[model samples]
Target: MSLPIVIIGSGFAAYQLVKTLRRQDTQQAITVITASCGDDYAKPDLSHVFTKGQSANDLIKMSADEFAKTYDITLLRRSRVESIDARQKTLRCNGESIAYQQLILATGAKALVPPFQGDAMGRIITLNGLEDYAASEVELKKAQSVLVIGAGLIGTEIAMDLASADKRVILTDRAEALLPSLLPDFVSAQLYQSLGNQGVSIELGTQVESLRQAEESIAISLENGHDYRVDAVVCAVGLRPNIRLAAEAGLKTNRGIVVDRQLRTSDPHIFALGDCAEIDGNVLAFLQPILMSANALAKTLLGQASNVALPPMMVKVKTPRLPMQLSGNTANADANWQVSASREGMTAKAFDEEQQLIGFVVTGSHMKQGFSLLRELPPTF
Candidate 1:
């Protein structure tokens, strides 16, 4: 007779929330509506599955039916939330209306696809979810070489993965270095060289102008004037938060769905987390923040207001060619960092205006110092 708590995603954020909430209140009615197959899998695994020789099916931790039964929650798969009626405390999904005691928007972000000029229908792929990965696997199986656009976290990891699979990989980006937003030139240059040593062709500081269909492969035109014909094309540009439903419902949104420290959106009964949420004017799409938010949101859902603990987060890049660890805030792409490099490894630290330790990067054998440097980074988030 009572409405169930509705979550609008099935990603790690949604899974963790349900797990955390169930720990305190096992009998609470919960429902998850997902656009995908609702399989339980670590999304981060998609990027490096190739290195492990794993398929999309292998990446699945649990199926939708199994997850639903295990958690004792309703799972609506292959469904999309069409709209949200914030005032009515209900949402329309697939032409059906559902009411909720509390609405959690864990919709997550979408893979950003840059605009291309030529015919780029089935030739290009961006792996953001299970289905996308499946589609990419099909393309990669027949392709001998791959062109990866955007040398960010996803781009670099995927390039390394493809190379490990014995595919010729060409990594390109608008920035002069890989992971420009997260690493300084010195740090990225080291990674660039490492990937190069691993047989990856690094194409930096160029824009992809068009994608045309060639006789045997896809023709990619770069703004730098050099052209290439590759068997496959993949884009790892970045992600943009899913804020449409929130914004359409009049919820406050900036870079993401605006939320307080408690993960509460503009509406009292609505909350958001993970890639879709901006908490306290900051949007963090990292794993640690998502886990912290889920734990805090679970407390709030159980009738207690708890704020997520802001700590300097650590991210371990999945490139085995050159292992990397980043701690603290490296959100600024133009940060002036001081770096020290040796054959053993590389270490870079960022400082604030007042000489406070703000961020640092460690790569290769130098990760032994990651735990200590993580402590030195400021909790700016």
Candidate 2:
């Protein structure tokens, strides 16, 4: 009997790897352990639930039993992994010792909740998974107004969704413009104007100072000397990779669990991918890189010795009013942005010192050019 290959998550990375591996080789014992109910859902849909009219239940693409039967693999749902004994090649999950030939960590990421003063901290919510989305749905039903902290991708999307649903939305961020890390000033300015036109109160260059419970609402104080009362607060600041388990298991970790080109961790028998993995010092929390890593890791696990090579990937910001797409130079460093604005929309191109196109942003009618612009940018890795 062969020992099973164990996967420690059931997200996109874990399932994608399993799907990729099973396509090449059948009859390889595979076991998946997940802390959740093991439902297959598109995580990107979580932010657009309001605008799409999707409930939390609608987000689930596949149930645990369905996934298990479809893939012919063992699914352990709602089981928390206690610890991993690397030397013994065993995992202690829910007090059960399970041995494995290989281990893959796809634990994903967690929402970063910054500490703030106030007794109504419980009213602050962060959406990182299905459970968070479900909770947000419940909260939204009871609230007429929402205060969103952070004007990044998730925050802006949620604000748009809520505003579209006739809810009052106030989107606040410490940065001067929206998507400051991903878009050029001109592109972000377009989105800022678009959101404001949609009745979203934009509060840039400000941070939440505190939250206090008011009569049937939460009162939020900002560092910019502004105070507002809202039914709920959603924190979309960012995500921190879930690396505690890997670090506890004695695996090397930085922003995420350290991995190589093949997605192998410090321990050869252990591997990692998705939001939990930092490959060659790059933590790609996007779907494209995760899929790329999954393919390479699947081949490597099957003795193919594959290495992941990713091209420049485009990030589509799902703001219906603005409809922007950005590719490359998300850091906005060491590049000059040359922007052209018109009634149709705005196109901003980022060029390096060599006068080569390194990144680009397309908004509104010009968003159709996003693919062509992506081709001009250099490969990410």
Each candidate: RMSD to true structure?
1.8, 1.3
Model 2: residues with Cα > 4 Å off, grouped in runs: 330-334
Model 1 C-alpha lDDT per residue in residues 1-381, reported as the tens digit of each score: 668999999999999999999889988999999999999999889878777878899999899999999999999999999999999999999898999999999999998887889986467788888889876786687788999998999899999999988999999998988887787777777788889998898889898999999887899899999898899999989899999999999999999999998899999999998999997777888888899889989999989999888777789998897898987766555466777888878888888777777888888898888889888876755
lDDT of each: 0.88, 0.89
- Tens-digit lDDT track for model 2 on 1-381? 999999999999999988998998888999999998888889999778877778889999998899999899999999999999999999999898999999999999989889999999888888788888787788776789999999999999989988988889999999998988887676677788888888999999989999999978999999989899999899999999999889999999999999989889999999998999998888899998899889988888888899999999989899888887888885566788788878888888988888999888887898888899888888888
Deviation of model 2 at 58, angstroms: 0.8
Name the TM-score of candidate 2: 0.97
Indicate the worst ten consecutive residues by lDDT in candidate 2. 328-337
User: How accurate locally is residue 213 in candidate 1, as Cα lDDT from 0 to 100?
Assistant: 90
